[model samples]
Target: MQRMAAIDPIAYGANRNHYDGAVTRLSPYLRHGVLSLKEVSEHVIALVPTPRSADKLLQELAWRDYYRRVLGERGDAVREDLEPYKTGYQPSDYADALPADFLAAQTGNDFVDATVRELHETGYLHNQGRMKIAAYVVHWRRVKWQAGAAWMYAHLLDGDLASNHLSWQWVASTFAAKPYLFNLDNLLRWTGGRFTGCDADGRSPFDASYDELNRRLFA
Candidate 1:
C-alpha cells in the first residue's frame, strides 16, 4: 500500500481550467488523499445544476483518471523510442533547429515571443496559444518534437508527461498524418491582438508582401 501525505483542497479548485487565470488552488487535495475524485465529481454535479456544464466537468475529471491509467500502463515506454508506425526506426541524425532566443521570448516576432513569455511567466498558455506555439516550434523553426516536449516539460506547471509528450509528437507530424500548422492571421485574432501578428489596425505581417511569413516559416 502507498501511504500519502495530506494536501490542501484549494489547489484542485484553481487548476480546473488550463489557462493563466486557472484557480488550481484545490489540486493538491485531489492529487493526494485529502479529497476523493468521486467526491469532487459529485460536488461539481451538485453545484453546476445544468446538465451540459455538469457533464463537461465530469468529462474533464474522467480525463484525469484516464491519464493516470495510461501512465501506469506505459511506465518507461512513455518516453521510450517506440515509433508505433515505423518499420525500422532508429534514433539517429535528428535535425533540430530550435533557437534559444525563440524559447527565451527574444525572437523579435511579437506573436511568437508573447506566447512563449506567457507560458514562461504564468506556467500556462491559452489553448490557441498552445497550438500556435507548437506550430511555431515545429513548422516555423523545424525543431524535433522530442526537443519541444523537453522544453515544455521543464516549464508548464500542470504538464503531464502523457499528454504533453504525445501532443508534441502529434503537432510535429511524427505521430500524425500531417504537421499541425495555423495561419498567422488566426493567431493574431485568437489572442485579441495582444501578440499582434500584424499592426494596431489588424494588418498582418504578410499584407505588404502577400503574407509570406507562412512560406518563410514552413519552407
Candidate 2:
C-alpha cells in the first residue's frame, strides 16, 4: 500500500491483456509461500490447457528463479560495476544527464512527462514504458543503469531484484551494449497514447486513437 498508492488493472496479473511486466500481486504470496511455483504452475496449466497466457505467466515465474540463481552465483557483483580493470571503461556519472524536473515529471517532454506522471501517481509503469524510461535515463541522460534500477526498486512494490537489476543492466546496454531508443510515433502506438505528451508544454495532449496507434505500432 505504501509503495504504490493505487492498483492499476492494466499492470495486474489477473488482467490477461497485460502479462508483460510488474503485476504487483506476487509480493504477498511470496511472503506467505502461498503461491509456490509448482502450485501456481499446476493450477494455471490445469485451467487453460494449452494456454499461451499461462505459458507467458509461467515464464515470468521462471525468471524469478533465474534471477535468484544469478544472485547466488554473483552475489555482490550483481549490483556493482562488472567492467574489468580501470583501462577498459570509465565509470559514468549520470547525475548531470538527468533533469531533476523530468525524473520528477517536471520536465516538459510531453510523452515522457506523461509517463513519469503515471509512474509517480500510480507507482506503475507498463513494460514498454519501463523500457522507454530506461532508454531516456541511460541513453539520453547518460545516467548509470544502477541509479535508475535502484530508483525503481525503491518505488515498485512488486520490484524483484533479479528482474529489476538485470533488466536495468540490459537497458543501460551494460548487458546488450546498446541502449534501446523509441520514437514518439512508436511510443504513441505502444501506449495507445494512454499516457503521452499532453501538449507543447507537457500539459496532456490526450489526442489519441487506439486503433491507429496499434496499427502503427504493429506495422
Candidate 3:
C-alpha cells in the first residue's frame, strides 16, 4: 500500500509505456478489491496536487471503470467479439488453441519469447508487452482472441475478464477499426535495446513496416 501511496503521477504518465516504467503496480490489488479505483484516484490527486500531473493516472483508472461498464452491459458477450473483425476473418476462422511455440515461448521473436516467459514466471507483464503479445497471437498466429484471453486470465494475478478479454478483442480488430501491430523498432525503443540485433534473420515476423505488415497479415 505504501508503494501505491507513493506513486508519482507525472513520472507514471511519462514512462508508463517503457518496460521498466514507473507504474504503480496496483492492478492486482485493485482487481481483487483490496483498493477501490475512486479511492486510489482521489489519493493520487491529493498527493500530486495538480490536475495535469494526475490526469493521466486517473484516465488509466477510468479505463478500469470503462471495462467494468462494458461487462455490465454486455455480460457474457464479453467472451466474444463485440463487433465484426476488420481483418475480414470470422472468429471461427481462427484456431481455438494457441500455438505450442507461443505457449513454450519459442516464437523466434526474442522480445515475445521473453515476455511470455515473464508472464509464466511472474504472473505479470508490462502493459506494452501485453499488447504486443496479444497482437502477435491474434494477428500473426491467427489464434482466436478468446483463446489468448483465456490463456492470459489463467496466468495473470491481476486478471479482470472485462479488461483482459476486451483488450484482446481490441487487438484482434473485433472492437476497433484496425488491428494493432508492433514492429521491431518500436519494441527496441520501448524495451531499451534488450532485444536488438535482428537484422540478419529473415524469420523475424515483426520486422516489417506497418504498411507491409497490414498487407501481409490482413491482405
Candidate 4:
C-alpha cells in the first residue's frame, strides 16, 4: 500500500528503463500478495487526470497479469523453448549450463560482472539490468535461456515464474521475433557511465557497434 501510494506514474513512464529511475519497486509486494494489482491500478487511475497519464505504469501491471495467464495456460512448458533458435545457432550449439566464470563474475566484461555482483549482494535488480544481463548471458555467453532463467529466479526477490522464464525466453529469441542484443553505447547510456564495459585488463567484448555485434554474435 505504501509503495502504491508513492507511485509517480509520469516519472515512471519517462524513466523506468534507466538504472536509476522512479520505479515503484512494488513487485515483491504484488508477488507475495501484499497488494493486489487491481487495487494498485485503481490507485494510479485515481492519481492522474486521465488513464493515459498513467499508461506506462498501468501497462506494466497488465503485463504481469498477462504473464500469469500464460503461466496458467502453458504450465511447465514455459521452462522449455516455445520456438526454435532464431540466432542462426542450433540448440546443440549453446551451452547447457552457465559457465563457472560467469557465476563468479569473472567473465572479463565489466558491466556483466558488475551486474552479477549486484544481484548476488542484493535480491533486487532494475528491469533494465535484468534485460541487459539476460541479453549478455543468452546472447553473448551462448548459455541456454533455461540456465540463465533458473539462476535469476533462484535469486530474485520478486521472482515470478512466468516473468522470469518468459523474459529469458525473449532475450533468447525463443519467445520473440529476434534475439535481443545490447552494445557498449546502449549499456553506457542506460547505466549513466557507471560501468565502462572495460574488463579489468582493459578489454571489452561489449565494446562494439550494433552492426558489428550482430555479425559477431548472431551472424
Candidate 5:
C-alpha cells in the first residue's frame, strides 16, 4: 500500500506506455480489496497539485469503475460477448480451448511468447502487453475470447471478472467497432526493441500495416 501510495501520477500519465513505464503496480491490491478505486483516485489527486496532472491516471480508475457498472447491470452475461462480433466469424467458429502453442508460450512470436511467460511467472503483465496478447489470441489464433479470458484469470493475481472479461471482449470486436491489432513497428516503438518479430526473415504475423491487418483478419 505504501508503494502504491508513493506512485507519481504525473510521471504515470507521461510514460505509462513504454515497456518500463511508471505504472503503479496497484491492480493486485485493488482487485483483492486491499485498496478501493475511490481511495486511489483521491490519493493521486492529493499528491498531484494540478488536476490535469492526475487526469490520465484517474481516467484509468474510471475505466475500472465502468467495468464494475457493466458487471452490475449485466450480471453473468459478462461471461459472453456483450455485442455480436463485428467480424464475420461466428462464436462457434472460434476454438473452445486455447491452442497448445499459446498455452505453452510457443506462438513463435517473441513478444507474445515473452509476455505470456511473464504473466505465468509474475502473475502480471503490462497493460499494453495484455491488449496485444488478447488481440493475437482472438484475431490471429482464432480462439474464443471466453477461453482467453479464462486463461488470463487463471494466471493473473489481479484478475477481476469485470476488467478481465470485458477488456477481452473489447479487443475481440464484440464490444468495439473493430478488433485491436498491433504491428511490428508499433511493438518496436513501444518496447525499444526488447521484443522483435519472430521470423528470421523479419516478417512475423504482425508485420502488416493496419489496413492490411484489417483486410486479412476481418475481410
Candidate 6:
C-alpha cells in the first residue's frame, strides 16, 4: 500500500526507460498477487488529471494482464517458441545454455558485464536492463531464448512464466514484430553514461549502425 501510494504515474510515463528512472518497483507484489492491475490502474488514473496522462504506465500494467491471459490460453507451450526466429536462424541452431563468459560477468562489453553483476547481486533488473541483457544473450551471443530466460528466471524476484518467457521471446524475435537491437549510442543514452558500451579493448560489436547490425546478426 505504501509503495502503491508513492507511485507517480506522470514521472513513470515520462522517464521509465532510463537506468535511474522513476519505476514503481511493484512487480514482486503484483506478481505474487499482493496487488492487481485493476487496483494499480485505478490508483494511477485517479492521480493523473486525465487518463491519457497515465497511458504509458497503464499500458505496462495491462501487459502483465496480457501475459497472464496468454499463459492461461497456452499453458506449457509458453516455455517454447510461439513463432520462428525472425533472425533467419532455426531453433536447433541456437545454443542450449548461456556461455561461460556471460556467467562469469566477462562478456567483453562493459555494459553487459555490469548488467550481469547487477542481476546476480540484486536479483532485480530494470526493464531496460532485462531487455538489453536478453538481447545480448539471445541475439548477440546466439544462445537460445529459453537458455537466457531460464538463467534470468532462476534469479529474478519478479519472475513469472508469462512475463519472463514471453519477454524473452519478444527479444529473440519469436514474439515481437522485429528482433530487438541496440547500439553503443543507445546504451550511452539510456544509461546516463554509466557504461561505455565497449570492452577494455575499446572496441564493440555494438558500435555499428542498425543496418550493419541486422546484416551481421542475420544469416
Q: Which tens-of-lDDT digit does each residue in 73-120 have in candidate 3? A: 999999978999898787788999999988998866677788889999
In model 3, what is the error at residue 120, expressed in angstroms?
0.7
Candidate 2 lDDT, 104-137, residue by residue in tens: 7766676667777777677666777778787667
Global lDDT of model 3: 0.87
RMSD of 4: 1.1
Give candidate 5 misplaced runs (Cα > 4 Å). 200-202
Q: Rate the local accuracy (lDDT) of all candidates.
A: 0.58, 0.60, 0.87, 0.89, 0.88, 0.91
The better-scoring model by lDDT among 2 and 4 is 4
RMSD in Å for all candidates: 7.2, 7.8, 1.7, 1.1, 1.2, 0.9
**TM-scores of all candidate predictions against the true structure:** 0.64, 0.68, 0.95, 0.96, 0.96, 0.97
Which residue runs of candidate 4 sit more than 4 Å off their true CA positions?
Answer: none
The backbone clash count of each candidate, in order, is 16, 5, 0, 0, 0, 0
In model 2, the runs with Cα more than 4 Å from the true position are 1-34, 51-53, 83-90, 96-98, 197-219
Residue range 126-219, candidate 1, lDDT tens digits: 6556666776676556566677777876777657676677666666655566556666556544455565564345554433232464455443
Q: So what's the TM-score on candidate 6?
A: 0.97
Q: What's the true lDDT of residue 161 in model 4?
A: 92
Ten consecutive residues with minimal summed lDDT in candidate 5? 195-204
Q: Which pairs of residues have clashing backbones in candidate 5?
A: none
lDDT of 4 by residue, 1-219 (tens): 567778999999999888888999999899888889998998899999999999999999998998889899999999999999899998888999999998999987788888899888997898989998999888888989999999999899998898899888988999889999888888888888889888788977888988888899994
Regions more than 4 Å wrong, model 1: 1-40, 55-57, 80-94, 198-219
